[model samples]
Target: MPAAVAELSPDAPAVLLAPLLAQFAAVARLEHVTRAAVELGMPQPTLSRAVARLEQELGVALLAREGRTVRLTRAGRIFLAAVERGLSELERGAEAARAEADPTGGRVAFGFLHTMGSEAVPMLLRGFRADHPGVRFQLVQDYTDSMLQRLREGELDLCLVSPRPDGPELTARRLGEQRLRLVVPVDHRLAGRQRVRLREVAEDAFVTLEPGYGLRRITDALCAEAGFTPRISFEGEESETLRGLVAAGLGVAVLPPATVARPDVAELQLSSPGARREIALTWVTGRPLTPPAEAFRAYVLSVRGQLPLHS
Candidate 1:
């Protein structure tokens, strides 16, 4: 161990040096023994002994006494600058931690897919804020893979994701189920039908999410189960946009019940091998959540049955 670490009292860990370093800063700023002692609210004799101990612990001469005053040694100037920055950063970190832990006004960094932001997330947050009006949220709208990456990197406190979390590091709770419907342009042959099998639309061109999105994976899986790969005619980031493509007669799409509202398009329930996607609330295992986020997660799990779904 270095001399400074070795000199720490056996019972007092090195964390104690942070405050002692602040004392050295107080004395160095004043440069007068009596004045620094007064500013520190300590007796001159006690402050003097503390400085001597500091120098001994570091194996360096930090101060030069000239009769009644003191001046910093060359090494002391460099050390003082570093100490001030360190102490200032520690203070900021403490303040941030306290703010994040506050029961009523803490912050939560929340993430979810674009599919949820329009109705689901807004409704969730509105209810959450009714109970905690002062809590702040940082919302991140992303696909599953991107959201999962941000969650692991500590950028998000929790995520509402789909196709249930798979990694060993993830902890997931199934929130509820959403039934997907086949959407087609009003003039298409399948539009008037209230229900159809997935295989019935096999030859139709499809509009889907980009491959990286979770919904796209679900779409591919449903297609595979239906015995054919879709010939994707259009791919976009938003479900509403895909619905628009269907409305324009560009292609048919499989979409969640909530996002398929357009006069020009019709939503039909699947008959055989019913199509649906499972929604889940996911977080990192063993990672702690900010107080506000934990509250939101608990609130969501408690009220999941009330989540909007097709009747």
Candidate 2:
């Protein structure tokens, strides 16, 4: 253990010293010296003295007395902001160090688009837990654009996306492609057709995904290529809700086979210029993969063939 400095002086910034800044940050964050000390697993008096020393060195009162609570002074608020920033930088540095040391068993944050999460996420999680149980997995469901942005900002360790953007900074591997099918109620007239064409159903009332979703983009582009614009009767975010709408005879929709394979609907392949969605796993180039993330990626690819509708 390193020797503790007795005091911070005018020449030295308290934020530059870890122990002093940590003590101050804890007290500032918790606003109670006893609670902060308990959380930090240090003696309350020792933590309180450290905070007092930091306040003396900074030449400002950092805490204000309330009836039964301690609050940050205005000066303390400003100093705490700087301390938070410093702590964030330190956290990243520590993450980088952990990445260097283990290259696995560290925290991994991942994001997946809504459609993929329907089935793929469960498979990935199961396999990941089986293989690397120690690693923590933080998974979030987001749109493609948002997920990609999170990956770029280092907020996510990996993302599963579709129609991957062409770029040098991103690395991607094709998981598989899924054929699009028109989902309709079993009692609907279109359900009896051996196969459907986009043009035939071009004008049908439809419950489709919102504009920016990968499925919606594919559906719109395919309809345009087929020489007609789809008449969208309703727009929704979840594939399950869209399927439910179709089952209720509200409207028809084009979706990946897996989505329509649910019990309430019948899926039909489109004959002309068949629509397909390409799924891929993406991550930042040159960044190390944490154990859970790597396991999840491998599991997705491994189970791709077994998925009900994946091609």
Candidate 3:
């Protein structure tokens, strides 16, 4: 360790030297203790003592007197260079922090399920931006569990999730529920039906989102309620991919209503009572959001029953 770090008292962390560093830098820049003191709005004697204290803390001689003026010694020049860079970085950090707090122009770290990316999320974002165009969003598309984990880790400010996650750690608002459909290849026998019972497909091979996804869990539960375990033939991370697999007749899938029409598959309504997944806006229960995040949350809730659930 350098002499300065070695000499510091346990309670006097290097952070405590911040003000003294500023004082020292001003003095070093002016090369005249009295004049630097005047520019710094402090008495010359107080400035002199602060500079001395800084030197003592650093265990180095930083200045030399010439007549009534002062000059930085070689050590002072080197230390000043480092201090100036550190101060500049700290200033930049402060500016970024302030910018994040700006209500109209700040950034919001928003997360949502991949299922919503096709339409619902984009629609919400477009409507929110219509009124607050300057606000920026950092969007994360993820599974419900992963998104909630990021929310807890401070990586996400808000999320639109399904199955309405619950716990002491989360705050969730029910936005509205969207109907889940049973999608089948167009040539399949049941594809001609406007609606079908969940149990009707009990023997059909299933294509689904992979395990750990909220929709997957819902699919499994609905299948169990329908009195059979789905024999999943293919699993994927995205709902669109599953839809495509269904189109290829790989297997049928349970999915949210499609935003765009796909002539290759037919979407049928479920006769099951709970074939719907609830959508919610979620965040860490006790965590305070930045201004932009809070604004976006309020805007989302304001639209409550108005989310574009279908294309």
lDDT values of the candidates? 0.84, 0.79, 0.88
Candidate 2 residue 219 C-alpha distance from true site, Å: 1.2
Model 3 whole-model lDDT (C-alpha atoms): 0.88
What stretches of model 2 exceed 4 Å from their correct place?
A: 1-90, 99-104, 259-263, 291-309
Model 1 lDDT per residue over 217-236, tens place: 98898889899999999999
Error of 2 at 214 (Å): 1.1
For model 2, what is the C-alpha lDDT against the true structure? 0.79
Across 1-311, the per-residue lDDT of candidate 3 in tens digits comes to 32343566655746567779888988888889988999999999999999998888889999999988888899988999998877765764564578666768888889998877877788889999999999899999999889998888677889989889878899999888888999999999999999999899989999998878899999999999989999999999998999999999999999998878899999999999789999889998866666778889999999877777652
lDDT of 2 at 103: 53
Q: Please, what are the lDDT tens digits per residue for candidate 2 over residues 1-311?
A: 55466776656564345679878888877788888999999998898789888887779999996754589999989988988877876786677677656755777788887877767777777666786777777888877777888888678888888776569999987777787888889898888887988788776898998877777888888888999888888999888888899999888998876644577788898886658888888998976565556666677677866654466
How many residue pairs collide in each prediction? Answer: 0, 0, 0
Residue clash pairs of candidate 2: none
Candidate 1 residue-wise lDDT at 278: 82
lDDT of 3 at 122: 87
